[model samples]
Target: GIFGARPYKTFYVENDQVTFATLDPNFKEAVKLSADWYKKGLIDKEVFTRGWGARDAVLPTNMGGMTLDWFGSTASYNSLSTGQIPGFEFYPMEPIQIKDGVKSVTVGRNTTPEIGWGISAASKNPEQAIKFMDWWFSEEGRRTWNFGIEGKHYTMVDGKPVFTDYVLKNPDGKGPLKVLQEVGAQVSGPGVQQDAEYEFQYSNDIAKQGFEMYMKDGNTKRPLPILKYSPKDIKELDKIMALVNQTTEEYMQKWILGVSDVDADWDTYMSRIQQNGIERAKEIVQQGYNHYNSVK
Candidate 1:
């Protein structure tokens, strides 16, 4: 509901075809709904004025209300507010259903993480480096990378790696993240990192509940494919979209803040967006997408 009813991106593929979704009908309806919600006081009055730190500034106070955020951080507040405010809690809600019988797709990560290890071409021992990287994905190496050494940071509990008190409940007042950094269990290196129980042990029960809810089948899915465009295509897209994105953000803010009526201003906004080269941007993205699928 922040931008629109439908998930909005510069471009997203639906039915294996690229679409300029910001100008699409579903997003138009979303703009209208945002306007309506703003008028009805469902949205924060200070939404536009507040910077990204709004979460930090607002959430600790009594005035803090609903927010759409990551499951882990969202649940952290419940623990943060524990002694300060009685009965203060935050939990994840299922994505709002805009239309009956249609499930909403929560934008999720690609299976292959964007970050990875790479050996330098000038490396003296490239073969040794390759072997070292390969070891991280192996069974024993995975356990070491994800859980640290046996009987130190973790121990076998019914053939599962369970974090010890050093990582879970630090003797000092350090949080799980800090302890994990010291213990070297949760570093972002090459590995599967399939240790679900690690997150459960670190996070509070509320966060665990939210994690379970979102991880259930059909609750989350990747929204876009990992499409790589040529440098020339990227340069062209960047030029076109810089102006187009500016226009879209301007109109979305205006509509959501009630500075202008969505019904009155939408046509002009669409014209401005098109004049800013949305069509050309779509064409470039489509070309890249088509090439991506053909190769696949």
Candidate 2:
């Protein structure tokens, strides 16, 4: 139900001015431009039908002489330098303007803490479970989980934890970190908090870049209103959302793959969505938003 329009972060040659149509622009112009790019072989043909990995098949081995990528941040550049594409170069672009003269980048809010843990209600040892949870959050536990045994997995670097060469290289077929994760020895639960230093100590350049991107773009984007719903409301919303999303995915794919003409088929697709009560769904979302705002 949330349908806020945003600009795309484009990767182009240095000093090139981007000219792609915005999401809310006239459909004719947008379709025409998109089709033109496809016809000219400038845009990847698989973009409409397949994902980036598949599309990468068409890229020249040397990346078609492209030196820039629209990535989250410089940290991303560092992280992505793995052996997948040896000697690949990446340059980050500043946020740019799009339609309606709006300048912004898209981002998602930080996930809530309770995203990944749950205790079975039928557990016989609930007290033990609670005690274990408490112990897991203790400082000693955090250090053990994040840094591993001081000398084995990591070493102290001026009092900061640094991964050993073996861990960094992921030397074995399955690294020590992966083994720890499988055993649930880390903060694998929702709502669990860890020290920022500990988190950063284990993060690679890609993670740092992602954090920088989020901070930078989050400061400029129009804030999305948070919403909450009642149980009944949630059930109804989920049902309607599934239908709407299915419809959107179908039509978007059809349009991109040239299976359906955008000009002639778009109105029909929109009308079908209207019949599915997208407007009512939107109203329900708005009500939730209003309620959440009121509580805030």
Candidate 3:
């Protein structure tokens, strides 16, 4: 919810135009609120310096109360920190509202799959490779890919496939996720439809409950589609947005840290962003998005 106070991305398409909502009134309010929270010691002091291992550093030590992370990772902490922290429990909360009647939408998966497989042109067994790929989409193949081999990783319970003790309770002190990874189940990439049963059987009761709670009222929405840009356009965009993003992040962090007053520095920041070619960056993004939609 803290991060959701601002726009999800630096740039997003609105009404077919790439928009930089950082300058919006709501975003300004969010930045102001963050500064106020930091002053009141509400926000974490080490948030910026803690780096990626912040969760490992704070969560297990009982230093952090709550974290805004993925459902699986967050919920699993309840089990992972059982002995280290006597009563360490992480419950998934409902999406918080940014304003009185405006509920925030949790960003879900992307519009299109990110991973895919392809056959090489120089492959000797091209026909066999194609046949194997086609079989992966078949009913039995999907089941195997999602749930692993029957009687080995899972057993037929009544009519549905249930994970065996090997997956649910590994003897090597490894979690189900690790075991699943080792055995090559529940790791199917794009183009293979994952079975819901895998999730149902793998997740704990708390995780399952959280899943139902979050998906109840269209509380989630996919972000922008992965836009494909021409080679030249991509190079141009990379050059422009990289510096723009750096400036944005620098100012945002400084404001949140109360190192600089947002209101006082707002004009200077805007001038810097303008000078950084933010307008040109937005145009490139707009063109890419339009081209993507047109092709689709």
Candidate 4:
């Protein structure tokens, strides 16, 4: 597709500005392109209801074509390459430029780390919980969660963790994702940061190459740092965004699908939500950034 379909939210928070992408010239161009693609049937007809899972299910059977996905997860295509999909191929593509030289990959949403775990205040097994918590932060536990059983899931080469062929090419003809899932221990819960190195392991050659190429120009936009929020602040933020977010999603769907005219409807959409809850929410987010910077 000529357009990048991301940055879909009508609102974007950058530094101190809370801006509208619906009114952006570059983003409008992308929307126009997406609409054109939809008209041509080049875009999936069922895009609004369908997703990667649906596509993945059929792609293994050679029904459709390519899709954009996370760089880290792109290496899991070996499972689908078991000669079932005929011409199904997988590769990671570097960030591409869209109309007006808009970079496909940039400091944008979906790059932030957010999920975490916490113990209950009134737990029956406090001691067991404490022991497990300690183990989660341990190097050995992290290793187990990340690499799985070292010898079985991966091996050491020149003191670097090398994922074995069992992962690279599964003996049971399993795919990379399946093999890695079986062997690796996940450190995603509570206290562990995902080992960034494992993102490249046991994946295909093209994935590594693509990652390197994409990194040539740093394109990821990080979200605001974690900040303390009072319950009142949380309530205020939620109230502001709820309607705005819903309106954005609905309008976005209509605009992209040509249900509503992007040119005619965009301004009205912006104005409708402009003074709504957006400004105060923007202030709160900016305050979070400001607080984080001050502490740092």
Candidate 5:
């Protein structure tokens, strides 16, 4: 369960097996904590009653500061507040452990980078397109597209690319990334071969600091090998997850707001899903996990 969070859910993954623990004592504690906050008038008065846009409007007003969003989002919030707030900062903090020497935070995966250029079979300009694609992915072309001209946005220092002082210092009042954006410097995203080094250079100092904090402990779960799922399994998962997600959010909001008592209604909640093919859905996931390990 998350720290004093509403309607917290728990699942343990060990040796590639996944299982939920709604009846766990820790889950009960989290529910009680959330309810206590509501009772004491310490929580958002309209927490469960407002729509997303209205709820989010409170964050900028300092009504709610805590968030579960990632480093990039926190960086955006802090940067966007530059002229709006006085000395606002958000430093990413590592999670605290319930027990010493035990890690509790779950690690997730970033999309794997791969060489992905392809010319359309019906293209009239296939030859020219391929030539352009080749140059784009090349080292010299990538450096220029990602960092702009050397001696301008960046320069070579001891054979490694270094951002120039003007770029790093942002002397023109534009943020480092904004300045890079003006010059058509490539920003990493889907289908682009993300140059991690360029992204670090584009980010403001606070974001770079956050990145360092993420790497400081050096203890994180390495990604599992990419596994192919059968088309049948993929379709089944999509159908199951669609219903599961909608149901979970609706039920969770009720429980968190005390409209449904978690202790009294939790078993029925689990039973309802179990009757709706949860076992079969879980079997598919486990099979995929097994295949993932077996291939390597």
Candidate 6:
């Protein structure tokens, strides 16, 4: 959720057994509140009718009050600045934790690596690619990439590396960091070890706060480890998954728009899923989960 926006939180279930999850009370409350909002016309009528239209309209402007967006740190910073919405102040709220909750937040593994330099498998000069990769990971190359030409892009301040005034001021209008990237400065990616201090220096305060929040609230669940299945299984799973997602969207929209009575309609929706082979789908998912757990 956006920093300092609604008191948003996430709950995870072992599989898709949301009904059995300890978070049902909170979820029920949230759904009721949303329904109330719809009835009160506080939320847009087309919010559920049209996919993403409400979001597209609401997210870009300072509507109702100062817009609070649930977006990536980089995107949020860029929007506030580059999008020219001034007087925008960003403050990161402490990650909310449910007291006596059944589960704490799970932090996920398999984070996307920072950009890495990879040679094209079809490259003619495979040897050169190998050499470049080797050099890029070396200490000398890292220093050159991060610090830049000694006295130009950065200088040591209190024995710590700092961006030079020239870079900070963006005298050339290209921005020092942009210029460096354009010139193929750093080798970033999954395999690369970035200097944390260097990154901290360039990152905005809000971004830093967001990062901290992520560390605090992020999930610890690694991506489900599953292998490729038979083509028939793959096709069957895809069809069933698509149907489940479609059903979810339909019911969620209906519930949010006050078009469906939650107490009654929810049960009907669940029944429909059961009739549509939800148990079989759950079995497939469980198999995949089992495969992942076994591999890990």
Error of 6 at 151 (Å): 21
* Model 2, C-alpha of 230: deviation from truth (Å): 0.5
Candidate with top lDDT is 3
Which residue segments of model 4 deviate by more than 4 Å? 1-6, 9-25, 50-55, 75-82, 85-89, 108-112, 120-134, 149-152, 155-162, 181-191, 218-223
In order of appearance, the predictions have TM-scores of 0.70, 0.59, 0.70, 0.76, 0.62, 0.53
What overall lDDT, based on C-alpha atoms, would model 3 receive against the true structure?
0.73
Best-to-worst ranking by TM-score: 4, 3, 1, 5, 2, 6
Error of 3 at 278 (Å): 1.6
TM-score of 6: 0.53
Better of 2 and 3 by TM-score: 3
Candidate 3 C-alpha lDDT tens digits along 106-138: 656664465567999999999999899888789
- Model 4 deviation from the true structure expressed as Cα RMSD, one decimal place: 4.0
Could you give candidate 1's per-residue lDDT for residues 1-296 as a string of tens digits? 43434455447776776777776676777778778988998877888788755766677665677887655545666755546668887887765556764455466667665456889999999999999888878888778776777887888989888878876666764455556656665665553545555666667777777777877876665556666788998898888888987888888888888899888988898899789888888888888788887998
Q: List per-candidate RMSD values in Å.
A: 5.3, 8.3, 5.0, 4.0, 6.2, 8.1
Candidate 4, run of 10 with poorest lDDT: 1-10
Candidate 6 runs further than 4 Å off: 1-29, 40-56, 64-86, 98-109, 112-203, 217-227
Q: Which regions in candidate 5 have their CA more than 4 angstroms from the true location?
A: 1-12, 20-59, 76-83, 99-106, 111-193, 216-225
lDDT of 1: 0.72
Q: Indicate whether candidate 2 or candidate 5 has the larger lDDT.
A: 5
- Could you tell which candidate, 2 or 5, scores higher by TM-score? 5
| lDDT by residue for model 5 (1-296), tens | 23422123323345677544443455555666667777676678787666533324655566665555445434645643666566766666665564544443435444665224677899999989988878767888778776777888998988878888676666654445655767777544424555677666556667677677657554344444444579999899768766665666676677777788877877777777676556676677678778867877
Estimate candidate 1's RMSD in Å. 5.3
Q: Kindly provide the TM-score of model 1 when superposed on the true structure, using C-alpha atoms.
A: 0.70
In angstroms, how far off is 223's CA in candidate 4?
4.4
C-alpha lDDT (0 to 100) for residue 294 of candidate 1: 90
Cα distance off (Å), candidate 2, residue 114? 8.4
- In candidate 3, the residue pairs with backbone N, CA or C atoms under 3 Å apart (3 or more residues apart, or in different chains) clash, namely none
Give the count of colliding residue pairs in each prediction.
Answer: 0, 4, 0, 6, 0, 10
| Per-residue C-alpha lDDT of model 6 across residues 149-257, encoded as one tens digit per residue | 5677777678766877665556554434554565555533436555655556666667677567656534334333334456777688678656766675677677887
**Which residue pairs show collisions in model 1?**
none
lDDT of each: 0.72, 0.52, 0.73, 0.65, 0.62, 0.54
